[model samples]
Target: MRVGSMIVRPLHHVILAAFSFIMAFPFIWMITSAFKTNDEIWAYPPVLLPDKLLWENISKAWHAAPFDLYVFNSVFVSVCIVLIQTVNSAMMAYALVHMRFPLGRPLLAIILVSYMLPGAATYLPGYIILSNLGLIDTYGGLIISNSVSVFTIFMIYQAFRQIPREVVEAAKIDGAPHRRILWTMVIPLTAPYFVVTGLITFIEMYNNYLWPSLITHNPDLYLVSAGLRSFFIEGGAYGMNWAQVMAASSFTILPLLILFIFAQKFIMKGVSQSYGVNKG
Candidate 1:
């Protein structure tokens, strides 16, 4: 049995290593292609590694578009959505978990059901409403439209539910106000979940393309995703600079990668707790 187990373990390791490399190959290609020359990028056989690192690829991409403004717009929109969604979701989750309102559970059910609705189903209606409000091409338009994320609310609600009811009851018996309990106790208790939700929300908003593309026509209002699309469509020699495009894409994805690496601990904790699987 011990010899068989040893043989299986090595086989398992090899399989996992191969799978990881396969999954990571595109990103590796993207990073490497970002530094390759145009000829190298579209070479007959294609190159896995560049002959020489062309650092100019990055600078050329930066100058090819108004990435500074695009970055600022992306950061601003993502931050706004994250902040607003976190606070709102926390409040809503807290109420549903702790408050005694009759409509609370039904409201939660409705919100969860809404999550099943495809984003395509709501785009037309959302666009009409935003048009009526004259918010098109404005930051408020983008931020306000996405201020509420159903997934964030649901995840936080799950986290809040896992909190022991006895502690909340003790706080209530001690004459603590709902708001006080929520802020001072419940929120702190679920800090890991908040970090996880906020990080996810930031990444989603930053990468969002379709809604921003359809809603905002002004170049100045373009987020990173939208700006990258336009840049690719209208770019250099024969309307394409593959190296620059890859370089910009790499920079665009770097922050999210860094964030995930740094917060993976908290993210895993939050996921486990939300699923009621966290023990000890």
Candidate 2:
């Protein structure tokens, strides 16, 4: 039986490794194609390796659009979203998990249920609201509209719930006010969860295309995803620089990659706790 178990484990590992390679191939191909010329990028059977090794693709991509402004707008808007989302989520989650109040249970349930609500389903309403408020095409619109993420609320609520009530009760016994408990005890204890929430929000906001594209009519305010769409969709005179398109895609995804690498351990811990693997 032990030998059979060993054999099964190795087989599973091999299958998983192959699956991982399949999932990662597009990203690898994107990078390789970015370094190749247009012909090499779309060649039949696809060149697995880049021959040209030209840095020109990156240069062309950078010049093709207002990448710097897009990058700056993204960074500014996403940071605001991360800050607002994490802060609001932590406070709301903490309140729901640790404090008792009327209608609290149902309220928490409603918030969690919002996660299953698709953004596309709400697009028309969201657009109407933003336009009505004169927020259309403005940074104010995007940041305000996407600020409250149900996923962040739900995930952080789980993390917040796992923190022992005993510790909080002890703090209360020591005469810690509600605000003191939240600021000093609860927030400090849940720093890992906060980091996890921020990372998730950053990734989502950075990659968001549809809402931004719909609201933002000006090229100056285009996001990376929206800018890429313009090249791929709009067949103008300079349409479809395949190498440069791939290069821009590579840059668009790089920040998310770096974030995952930096916060890998914390991310794993957060998810494990979310799964009830660790309650404290």
Candidate 3:
């Protein structure tokens, strides 16, 4: 048994190494191409390594548009969405899992049904609602539209259900108020799921493009994804510049990369715990 286990360990490492390379290939190509010259981009059987690195192309991409402002906007919008989604989802989940409100079961069923309807189908209706509220082209429009992430509410509800009723009754016996128990006992028990929800919301908002493109015409308020699209539309003949496009892509993805690198395990572990999977 020990000898067989020793042989399986190296095989597992080899398989994992191959999987890692497969997942990382596209990123490797993008980084290499971002630093490559125009000639290198079109070279047959393209060289992965570029001897003449072009910093100027990246510099031009950085300066050609309002990247600083775009990044700042992206950060602001993503943060707001994360917070709003977390709070709204938590509230809804708590109501579903804890509160015995009228129409509670039907309400959860409705929420689940809403998840079946794709966002694309609701786009026009959502836009009309935003226009009616006079929130178009404003940060309020962005944040409010994403307030309730069904997926998040679903995950958080699972975590909330895992909370033992005995503990809640104990809190009540200790004279802890309802809201106080929710904040202290309930939220503390589900803190890990909350972080996971926040991370997922942040990634979603950071990468969104179509909604921002349609609603906000003002160039200044654009997020990174919309800003990148504008480069191709407004940059004209220079828009075809692969170097600049790749540079913008690299810059846009860098923050997400860094964030996931640091928070990946935490989010994964949290979600797994919520769903009772992959317990460590």
lDDT of each: 0.90, 0.84, 0.84
Give residue 122's lDDT in candidate 2 (0 to 100).
Answer: 85
Clashing pairs in 2: none
TM-score of model 2 relative to the true fold? 0.90
lDDT of 1: 0.90
* Candidate 2 error regions (>4 Å): 1-12, 275-280
Candidate 1 lDDT, 1-280, residue by residue in tens? 9999999999999999999999999999999999998899999887889999999999988887888899889988999999999889999999898999989879989999999999999999999999999998899999999999899999899889878999999999999999999999999999998998899899999999999999999999999998888877654442567888899999988778988899999988878775666555
Give the Å shift of residue 139 in candidate 2: 1.1
Tens digit of per-residue lDDT, candidate 2, span 81-187: 99988878878988898889999999987886787888899899999999999998899998999888888888778777767899999988999897889888887
Query: TM-score of the candidate numbered 1?
Result: 0.93
lDDT score, candidate 1, position 97: 89
For lDDT, the strongest prediction is 1
